[model samples]
Target: IMEYKRGSTLRRGQWTAFVFLLMIVHQCVGDIRYSITEEIKRGSVVGRFSQDLGIDVKTLSTRRPRIEFEGNTRYCDINQKTGDLIVNERMDREELCGQRPSCALLFDFFLENPLELHRVTLEIQDVNDNFPTFPNEVIKLEISESAIKGERFSIDEALDTDTGVNSVQGYTLSANEHFTLSVHTSADTGKYAEIVLEHELDREKQDELSLILTAYDGGKPQKSGTVVIQVRVLDANDNVPVFTQSIYKVSVPENATLGTAVVTVSASDADEGANGELTYEFSHISIKTKNTFSLDPKSGEIKIKTMIDFEDTSSFELRVKAKDGAGQAASCKVIVDVADINDNAPVILIKSLKSPLPENSPAGTEVALIYVQDRDSESNSKVRCSIEQNTYFKLSPSIKKHISLITAVELDRETQSEYNITLIATDEGYPPLSSFQTITLIVSDVNDNQPVFDEQSYSAYVTENNKPGSSLCYVTARDRDWRQNGTVVYSLLASDVDGDPLKNLFLLDSKTGVINLAGPIDYEEQPIYELRVLAKDGAGLVSYTKVLIDITDVNDNAPVILIKTLTNPIPENVAPRALWPWR
Candidate 1:
């Protein structure tokens, strides 16, 4: 079963159990491979991805199927809604794989939520888009008129970039009486043609020979290339130079310096004097070999002319020819193998990335797909990947040389919104080479925090009989979340004070949280008013705070006067006592 667990949950294990059943089909059926021809139209469906994986269509939103390429170029993409894997860009088999026999593009199909990976091999079939071509338009050779029958001369091979049957298969020589063609095939170097002398050459009768050599490929259209072979017959000389060895094998490090001696060739001639004396030169070598190495005609010494890089060309094969003063020649092949060195540093490629991740995302959420590449061979290319000093995120080994960056712990956007994660890759070479790539991760906010008031309760004093619609007191609240989730608004909760709604008596500003008097109040009617103010965030998370308003009395009532007794008649009658009753 393939499973990635950050913390612990039965849902994850259940998903793993589900995928484990699919793994049976995946392993038994081998890799999820698809074949498509070169230059396929973009958006063309390659295969049904989710159906092949036995994944449910309803869960595609959370699964988030995606494609991750091994190289920088992205050729295919997955459709989450339809479950179809479609071509993202046009592809050229010749441009992508060159002359490789099996042109397969290897990549991975990544599914999120449970974070499962399925390896996919996309085979790009070749097309007969190119014709067989020769390096040169004309091949020139010299031969002695006395050369006998059955003598063979080497011909430069034609090249075809297409692989398999589309490559050069055969050669045709224009009808000739003096010479015929002999085709040879090698496991290392494909097919090559040679010229064989069927009849003895006479310089007096024929001074020069011009023949046409045509090369054909096995393509459906059967395209071919043609070149002219010019043979110059010279006066007879009996001596023929022969090499000590037919083939020479040599090995040198790719870091070998220029002027480094690779090999030497020696030949002997049976004839004496001018006919026996021989000179050497390179013959029938490709442009790459000619530019890299040089040969000395006098000493017959071959030396490096330019630095050799194993990454570019691991080995080279060139032909060396020795000719006597009579123009009789013989040639041998020298194969130089270049050894590898740990010179290339590991490279980090981010195939797919999910940044600005929602802070509320689960622990096992896959953040990115990373791949490391080292151009060196064998142990030098083996690499170890890691994340530097990170606890919230960790690297999980995936399909060969690929790493999945996943959340190790739950994240809180309020604490840290941004993280700079550094990924380091180190190879297993003797003097280990290393490289690092830093990724910037952003944590998006969620409505996890509720609005909080500045104080638990508030107290304000207001005079009785104050003007209606006057400012009473202001209450403030703050939310920790960002953007719309952090926005807070205020309202007076519905409650009855003396069987009347508090909102009817007090007004709370939705934006500013300012409380205003809705109606007139008197100390005799209500001296103190108790109300609850509620704060809510944009996501509807709420908090409540109590507000107490004290009303002070004012001099608004006039003093009352009461006449206990009638003093008009008693004032005239009484003088000293002044205690007069009207009765």
Candidate 2:
């Protein structure tokens, strides 16, 4: 027989047994049956029974019935619900009666089976074992130098393995006076938190610093872990320098020597060290001479490197530079004044006067003086004079410092009123330089003596029958002056010596000095006539002379005649005498 246990109601170490009895006089036994009250537990066995008396017995179920019987032929019956057994035949033990009775036998057995056949159940339990970790393992952040305080920056997420309420809950940061940290939810997933910065860092004060972050969970007893963060600060340039004034002015003597200090300049910077350091330089300019100037590279002091003379150069202007070590620089202008020094000599351009002088001019006349000028400073600008050549003229000898009248000369118009003269002018410089000028003089003439005629006595003749107003001869006078001054006029001064004015009457032409008969002349009363003549200039300066005239007769009248009557008286007488004779 086999036994089994079920659920919590079954007990351990429990079993049930079955028995079979045989009857000798059995014609055909009615069906026998027995009952066992237990279900088949997992890993248990089922019992078997048979109906053939001479065949073996076997257990079977109508639901699972593919089993056979073997061994003893005696047959028995079984109950499937209770697992009980019963027999129907009896027989001897050995050869049908050899040893013992077979009808009174009992048997027991054990079974082994699979646990799956029993329908077993199991349950699992939970525990907190893992910590939270960052997804990236290492994180980095960047920011500009211009970022101000309270500026914010983003943080990466942390991870954990525990589920639900036991996972990563919140985050915290190490205490930092300069900075603050916070946790924020991820917009993409509510499963992660982001670490954020709430404060700013300054590079000028602190270049770099470190921070710590911790992640916590919602377990009954909270669990957490920390991560390290590094922050770096950057730099910027912002400071500048300035100069106090834009330009500087100074004055120095023109005769200053090389390396002579003229002036100094000053500047300031608000920065320190290399950023604020400064330097200086100069510019090129044109001057009267080969001289130069320079500025100190470090001190910014101005100085002259060559000699200065007012005669060569009078003034100058200088351009200068000022710079810092940072390569940033500025420029300024400087004015330099050079004082005066005496150095130049005087020069004379031209001198001389040439013109005619009237005759008989006075002895103290001023003919001409010299002209000159000097180019120099102060007392050296003064000039003086003298006459190197003074034969034809004389110099006064007292004139000085006056270029126009260095020497005075007198002119004489008598013997030789004309002269060619020369004069010289000199300056007061160390090696006094001199110059010369030349002039010329001329004489003029005046009127004085009266003119005279060449003859004192003269003669001429005319016929007694000639007409009046007829030309005879001309007379002339001479003067040294040319033209009108040298010509003379003539006039009759007196009558003839015959006492009969008509006998010597004559007329004289004033322009030609000619004589002619005034009336008809008779030789019986005056045979000759004489007269006095005068010659003069138009101004009436006079000279006198005499002229003689003579006359001749001609036959022109007839004689008267008377007659006598003698013949007639003779005839008459003869006749009377003859008559007296005849009577």
Candidate 3:
């Protein structure tokens, strides 16, 4: 066992010395193998790590071994005291192990008190669940007249190579006279059978007797052995009590109440009165049949003992024996089959469904496919699928137990972007069971709408000598399309007489469509300005609108008279009404 001392990390020199010492010690103790079970659920015990490592429990108590993965992921844990390794997470051979012949996880074992790294391989054993079988179909037993009553005989028992629940667990012998059956339990707890004589026999009347012994195990659908054994009464018994019939087959509803009478089996003796009188008792009963049925100790009647379920166990094979006061007995086989009843609702499975489907899909476009499952017996699992009252979608027949969700009408993303549809599945059972499933369908965006302007034209007024960058007016456009199709951007398309761009005269916010004065306004120069603005969307769709700004006039400018002089560019005139101009 590897010991990991938990404390401050040691220095490089000390670690190197520790490693050297460990290498010397490891050469003496060879590696060990640990066996574990594959497919074991999480939180289950895999193996005792310390025990498999040949470490004593007391030594393991001081140092706890921790299983560490590459990323320090904990898929299993180790018990400090017992050193047992238990699964902490789920493991899949095909996923983690893949197609490799063997899958193994190598982990570093850190021990507290003394630190050490030990490599261990856990071998996961596969589960054994094969059915049991007998090499021979029949066995012959010879009994002589000298054979005494109450004597037991030995016969070959069934053989099963598999282990665990897959191995033979018990035996069942069909009812017969002259011989009673007994099971021999092995040290491993597996069961085999032997034949015993119930009473003395006389050879004159009966020559041969026959019986069936079945060997069964515990597994899905169960596995078992079947064999025929013939006993040569080379001698016979006093007309062994005989049953009214050798075999009886019957059926009962699974809902049959406990203690309800199922079948009455009877046997008679040749001798009269008490000698002819007989009693009944069950033999070679199975675990499944024992819980479900009970037999009358006196009347040879069988009744329900517990709830009957066809799904769990369908039928029972029982042995009923009747013996006279003289000890002469006879037995018969009874097989009671449970009938199925409809009492469960259908289960729904969604196979193909797309979340957030694009809007405006074709009428026949598929939205989803629903599959229905039912547990009831035939004529019951058959189901019909339908969509709730929806104008946009409908359910169409696809295959058995499957229905396709198809669009019935053209969808408009603008009207409704998403839709939740309810699907109902109903079975053909009485008081039919039904189930509902809800799915959401989303409609995606498309560039189909043109930007809209708040108004075709907007009006505003500004005073002469108005400050620059003053808000004059606003123009807005809207589109109903989603995403990039609906967004609107504003731009200037006209300018003032100065031959400058309109953007220079007025600032327009592309997002809000607000227009601000870029330059001062003058009533004397320009009384009014007509601005054409364009709004465009990310989809390249555009719309145009206009803004009219009226500049109010103010009498602030005084009258001026200019006269050109002969020698200079500027001239002064003497008269106020007449002006002299120089070339």
* Candidate 3 deviant stretches above 4 angstroms: 1-237, 271-285, 311-331, 398-400, 440-450, 481-487, 493-497, 537-541, 556-583
Candidate 1 lDDT over residue span 137-238, tens digit each: 887777778788998877767887777898999999999889999999977558888899999888888889999999999999899999999888876667
Best by lDDT: 1
- lDDT, candidate 3, equals 0.67
Best by TM-score: 1
lDDT of 2 by residue, 186-233 (tens): 322224333343555566777666778778777767777667766555
Q: For every model in order, what is the number of clashing pairs?
A: 0, 11, 12
What is candidate 3's lDDT per residue for 1-583, written digit by digit as tens?
2333223222211000000111112111223345565567886777666766667878977765555543336677776667777788766543454223465664445444433445445555434434556545776554656677676664554555444565677888898667788888854224757778886666677767778888887655688778887766553333446788988899998888888999999887786655567877665454456667888878888999999877555667777767665445566889888886766566666655755666656787767655566656666656666778788897765432245677888778889998989877777768778888888888887777889897989999888887888888788799998878799899988665787666777899989989888887778978888898899998999889878889899887999988555653543645576655656
- Give stretches of model 1 more than 4 Å off: 1-100, 104-168, 171-183, 188-240, 257-260, 274-291, 305-307, 321-331, 558-583
In candidate 1, which residue pairs clash? none
Runs in model 2 with CA error above 4 Å? 1-344, 349-354, 391-410, 442-583
TM-scores, all candidates, are 0.76, 0.28, 0.58
How close to the true structure is residue 321 of candidate 1, measured as C-alpha lDDT?
A: 78
Q: Please report the TM-score between candidate 3 and the true structure.
A: 0.58
